[model samples]
Target: MNVLVTVTEGATVDDEFRIDGLAIDDGSLTTDLNEWDEYALETAVRLAEADLVDEVVTVTIGPEDCEGTIRQVLAKGADRAIRVWDDALERSEMLDVGAKTALLAAVVETEEPDLVLTGVQSADEGFMATGVSLAAAVDYGWAAVVNALEVDPDERIARVRRELEGGVEERTEVDLPAVLTIQTGINEPRYASLRGIRMAQRKELAVRSLADLGLEASAVESRLRLRELAEPESESEARVLEGSSEEAAAELATVLREQGVGR
Candidate 1:
């Protein structure tokens, strides 16, 4: 199996608020690999190491600064990486998940990977729609919020297990050349070993521009517009109950009912 994992250069939640002017874009804010994306990368690495996959490639669409993130994934055992550079992407203008999917679909088609994987949702946008949109663009079967995957190389089938309501799991099989959006906590992401980091530096990294993909800056459509960004209204302080345990429970239930949180 050959797998492609797409990652994004995302701002931290705080950074998002800061950029929106709810706060300040302080240098203290930290940025790193997205948690859900790490699960996808780790899953690909494990499959490669177990001999179930021949290679794992990581791809990201961002500015030049995103090269650090690509290197981090390469150090974790991806065979190679691809960086799609677009300066306008830095302003977070492509906020529509579908628009981002279109860009990724254009890249994935060129790679010709057997499977494409992405985080179920980005921590920053939390749209949770890219996987399905990308799959639609390429006309592939997609499994969303996948927790596990088993690939049958001979049959070219991928059995995917997904989470359902009430802690249940649903399984479905899709032909190879599919897309999956992986949920967080699917697996433990491996840290880059010293040896692995050294090896990553020598790996082939293909840098492609949007024009190389024959995509114009105006070709992608944005279904969403950010009218304004602001912090969520501050939550009111909680009130403590001054009564017995049973009374406190009753009060809690009353509060829930009043808030329409309980049926």
Candidate 2:
């Protein structure tokens, strides 16, 4: 019962990060293992420690520089790490779900893990589609925003409690060889120990090229094209109508009416 977790590179905007008109300078970007995926990986590690799973492996797709991110997960207790990258992939926008799903699909087929776990969304793009796309590409049943999971290896069934709208939860059972996109707060992720960090640097991290995965440059076409990027608007300022209660209430009603708002 091998469990595979997919990790993505999360990036932070540095002080030097700025937009030159519509084009952002990504050279100032600093990358790390995604926070949400860390939770997913932690869930996998707990399952392995409980003897519910035999092994835990992590996979990611990015440029050679991404090895560091993979090692970070290894330090957290993943048995093996696989990084898939190529010049073509580096030149392309990998945040597109199609290319990402294809890369993960290749890895899934090669590894043949019984269960796959992923974060609900990546930190950088936060598109929230990669996990679902991966499940579809692999033709595996999937549960999204999973907060609680219980696996019965003997029955090959997994009971999952997923978060829903209005502070509600939905419970369902998924067969083995399925996917689970974990939400944050599912568990507290463990920090990498000093010894584990040192060992991770020495661990042999496997690099898989597109060719090694039987994929071509054309095969991983990014179906999504990005347009202009912009920052979100700040929240509207709070207004304090100064005066007595009746005065403030009258002022508020007048202000609302002026703003085309009705009570």
Candidate 3:
């Protein structure tokens, strides 16, 4: 069995920052491997460590600037990495879920891994739909919000524990050649050690373009367009109620009454 883990570069904004039109100012943002993806990669590495899988590969759809993040994946435990990027992707303002699905679907076709793993959601966009969408695109079975996983290669089945709403947990089985969106807290992700980091430098990190994947630039053109970007409007104000407990309770009641929140 083989496993492919999908990862992405996630960005965090500075405490004080300004918007650069539709996006945040580049200088004020820091990028790294996504939080959720770390768990997904850890799951794949653990499978490899258990000798249940032959190879652990990671795929990403980002430009060359994200090579550092890809290196992190290698340093952790992926056998190799595939990075998909092109002029079309760099030119586009944004790649919607469908566009991303198409890109990933191409890689999935080329790799043909027995099991696909992805973070439940990207730290930046948080769409939380790519794993299922990719499964649909590749005609693979899929399960989402998976907190635990066990695979039987001979049986060709992936038993998964899904975290559902309201503290509910559902255990189910997905057929082989499937995609599973890994949820955080499934395991403790390890940091890249000094030796792992050195070894990663020698690992094969392949970069491919859409053309190499037999895809055209038109394949990445997104139908969705961003209309606007602005800060959310502040709708309420806060007041401090400082005094005896009884006095504070009375003030809270008065404030609630003023807002017509309670009778």
Tens digit of per-residue lDDT, candidate 3, span 1-263: 89999999998878777888989889988899999999999999999999999999999999999999999899999999999999889888889988999999999999999999999998777999999999999999999999999999999999999999999999999999999999999999999999999999999999999989999888778888877766677676867798999999999999889999887
Clashes of each: 0, 0, 0
Per-prediction TM-score, please?
0.85, 0.85, 0.90
* Candidate 1 similarity to native, TM-score: 0.85
Candidate 1: which pairs clash? none
Error of 3 at 175 (Å): 0.3
Clashing pairs in 2: none
What tens digits encode model 2's per-residue C-alpha lDDT throughout 1-263?
99999998888778756765545677867788998999999999999999999989899887777787888898988988898888888776444888888889999999998889999998778888888889889998888899999998999888999999999999999998889999999999999999989888877678899999999888788877766677667586988798999999999999989999984
Indicate which candidate wins on lDDT. Answer: 3
lDDT of each: 0.83, 0.87, 0.93
**Candidate 1 per-residue lDDT over residues 68-97, each given as its tens digit:** 888888999999998876655555655487
- Candidate whose TM-score is highest: 3
Better of 1 and 3 by TM-score: 3
What's the ranking of the predictions by lDDT, best on top? 3, 2, 1
- For model 3, what is the error of residue 135's alpha carbon versus the real structure, in angstroms, after optimal superposition? 0.1
